[model samples]
Target: MFFDARKNHQRLIRRAVSAALASVLIPLAANPAQAASYIRVNLIGYQSTLSAEAYLMTTSSISGETFAIKNASGSTVATGNVSATSGKWGSYNVYPISFTLSTPGSYHISVSGTVSANSPPFSVNTTSNLYSQGVANALSFYQNERDGANYISSALRTAPGHLNDANATVYKTPAFDSNDNITSSLSATGATIDASGGWWDAGDYLKFVQTHSYVVALMLVGIRDFPAQMGASSNSDFTNEAKFGLDWLQKMWDDNSETLYYQVGIGTDFTNANYQSDHDIWRLPQADDTYGGSDSTYQYIRHRPVFVAGSAGSKISPNLAGRLAADFALCYYVFKNTDTSYANQCLRSAEHIFDLANTSPGTLLTVAPNDFYPETEWRDDMELGATELYFALQSGGLPSGLPHTDPSYYLQQAATWAHNYITGPNDGSDTLNLYDVSGLAHFDLYRAITLAGNPSGLAVTQSDLLSDIANQIQTSVSQSKDPFGTPWAWGSSDTVSHEAGLSIMAREYYSLTKTGSYATDARRWMANVLGANPWGLSFIVGDGSLFPYCMQHQVANIVGSTNGMSPILSGAVVEGPTNAASSGSLDGMVTCPPNGEDSYKAFNGSGAVYKDNVQSYSTDEPAIDLTATSFLMFSWQIAGAPATTP
Candidate 1:
């Protein structure tokens, strides 16, 4: 109904203009009408204040467009004019509208006069259930991203169910050996390795250790900080999702050889005719191998291989190993009480990997020639692994096979690593401060100082770490240039992860100093992500009125189609808009509007650039790490007790 009015408005404008003028202007305004007149609101709605925006479809600016906020009883609660400050989308202008609701109830927006449109219904409430629901939905995304032994829960099932594959046993190709060495030809003696489990990295089926490690750490933090919020009840889905990744990570290690696999597969060639055939076809996990056929048709699936640790050809990536160590150590700390033997195993493996990584420094994981995740930094990973190992040893007692008999040795290692990281380049200068593990390193170090009892007695004091963290939060707040206060960067998806990181730091800072400044800033950032941005659109799918319907994810796209292509998994956060430098290169991938205009122009105006089309992977792909980070932020906001300080 909203789209019809927008279309009707466009038709009348075309009829009024000259044919020559209409030819150029119509295409700009004639881009497909969105389902809700580009009215973006928190699909889950807001509580204290109701904020939303109406994107005008017309190029000519209408000054006094009457907009009203109406309640479920169809009574107008508030009225205002569309803001004159218009967001330019090529020739079209998107208008802004906001109003405060006096009561908590279901509501929608109605625009009269020049632009006639109605928004989808939403809620206004004081309960934390919305955020809790967001966490649950975000965790469900991992279930949907599962590669083997996928979650079959009726409530969480978004993808087609399948049998376990490549986990029990997987064949090794010469192109990619067990030790991750690259070769020109297939191996003479085919080998089988047990490489199964873990989640697919993004819309594509590849898995990277760098990203996986980041995700696992965030989940562990969620469980640690808000056990009740993360469903600490027996066999909770949150715990189960985290364990899924941990189980797969354990398999990646070969104890005898002291090696770990960085990634399991390669992204399909984007230029190929069968660019995403692996996803387009509904095959089991093991189907991605040569066992089924030797024909050229099967080549795409057959070449997927696991990259392991070793030399230049088979580089023993310290960053990957360090992250793996951190994951194991953190799991040890969390699961030690319930599962002792399993926890002990994780502890032993964590210490071993940490030592191996520290001793063998320069062996970086070489990015497979065609692979996308090439990790460039190792300091943060090393810091996190050491910190977790120190805490695990201190809390859970010593495990057998450790290099040192004294737990303090591990503590000392952790403190040394932390000192180096804090003094290193992880200050707010680099955007890496947002998505990278440096913030985690700082958070863990702060915990070691205030909560964990600074056992190592390293040089830097607790006050220094707290000050640096406060400065980091302030820098992030100041850097946000958008009207909605969401920070922008080269990668919109990475920016989401970065925003989550800032929230994590802000919460920790609040815990330490009882200062509400960072916490208040953190809440605003969360609101921005929800729907308080320039686009007034929630970056998260299925959580807001104008959420992303057509994300660049293949599984979601196909699974969503089963439900008439609405959204598949709720609470799946999409990578938001990026700047020209980042999006310009991917212009060829976008197919919307057909005319090769800036793909960034695809979103409703407000300069909140993004595209819902499947081809716009840069701005629409939902990633595991990003979702994991969001889950952490949501759990903190919803599950943790309300802040007592201002």
Candidate 2:
């Protein structure tokens, strides 16, 4: 595996002896404590084409700290001194520095003083493909998240689970206590649907369409928007991964009956033991089939329950219907040329699902235990769903399965929804994420109009869409006053990824007008997650030297690594940080926080705390929704660069 090879190479790479740049040495009254000096860098390394940058941070501020770049052979390639302080973030004075490394070799930046500072080892890549291995690892994460049989061996997966989903019994949505758990046995709808495959929503086995729809839309969106990098033409693995998601989504939506099943399995509960929840158990997915508990609870665990948003053929919740419509429509756009039959199926489903969307939906149906994923925005989802539907229909001639149709109707619907998004209350509440996608929808809609002779017939104009995109990005930029140039929101790692995605959209969308200010924002946000943030740790597992070793993911802890290295969950991104961090333990979980302490607590400040421990799901849990945007971000970077070097 490339991930294993990369780790092995790190051990053999030659490191040049550190040589410091000459400095005046008229600095401090006393020696600055080396314990307080540090260099935070992008642990995954930098693109050779981009100026390699890092920050020199010190708790006890000192001037004239000489720095040097050492290559594999312990020879200094570049040297400099900390000229001035950039600014104070948190408790340290940060010195932002940039240098060039033209050679492709192992290298690191170090400072010269009574007690010198050295950064975690990083590589300078001259390879045409900088993030291919990262992209591969990201895909591996999806493989690890896979549910049902037909599983292939992956970096950390050998067995598949949730096979019961193949012919899973359908259950009516159940009432719940405050914690989003099933309170009683669900009434069977006298139906057993083929709800197999797709992904586990997070570390747990429970799945939901609220998050699944978002993942599928984003995956297909990446393929549609950045085809070359995603290898849509040449690479089949990435396509298959997206198709894996599309297939599961199709099962969730019964096209012939206009039914949309929104969730599967149950979550946390204390009162319900007869039907024990997934969170109540700590084990692998394969163990679910034979799980034993008092009161014959394993049947519910074995034959997982599926829940629908509404009755069959009734107006589906706009959020699910809209996003599902977008997923199917995007499938049509992506597969139309290669597989006409499957593409036609996608188009048919897209049209039918979009038609079932309740445009005036209030208290939008998400998942049971409504607070878990309370989505308030639907117009953006409808806008994107309608836009992609329009794209599917604009393919000149309808496919064998598709009959004569007017594409303008969907386009009009897309425009109206876009207008509703702008005039709606949720406009600036969130950026590009599971709950919000207007940042992407508006950009694509703007491009579509611009490419079609600047369409003057839409309910919303190109100017309106572009302005919304700019405002969304600007709003995020203005609110990001933390150490890193990111908002550090709930699910902060995903926010970091989504912000980068938004930047990519802004960069390309505004390039047409040549005034786009998002030139380096994408790289900046990417850096925050890769490293270069307050903790000097990569949020992505297996991508860098320092990352979350004790992620809240049960699979990683129960069967994966403990030393923060390979055989560990590769490419899963942790929730970076939140205002209030948390932790928990299961009955049979491994003893993580091996040292019995949050090693990263010192760096936690600015109203957010991050813990690389199993307890802190708020900060270290890896979720499918969090990993989706990172894939988009990495793929777009590859598209901007060149061929992936896997």
Q: TM-score winner among the candidates? A: 2
Across 2-54, the per-residue lDDT of candidate 2 in tens digits comes to: 00001100000000111121011112223543446567787777777566568
- Residue 225 of model 2 has an lDDT of 65
Query: What are the per-model C-alpha RMSD values against the true structure?
Result: 8.9, 7.0
**Model 2 weakest lDDT span, ten residues long:** 1-10
lDDT tens readout by residue for model 1, 335-388: 888888888888887877777774345524533532234344566677777777
lDDT of each: 0.57, 0.71
Q: lDDT score of model 1?
A: 0.57
- Residue 93 deviation, candidate 1, in Å? 9.2
| Angstrom error at residue 151, model 2 | 1.2
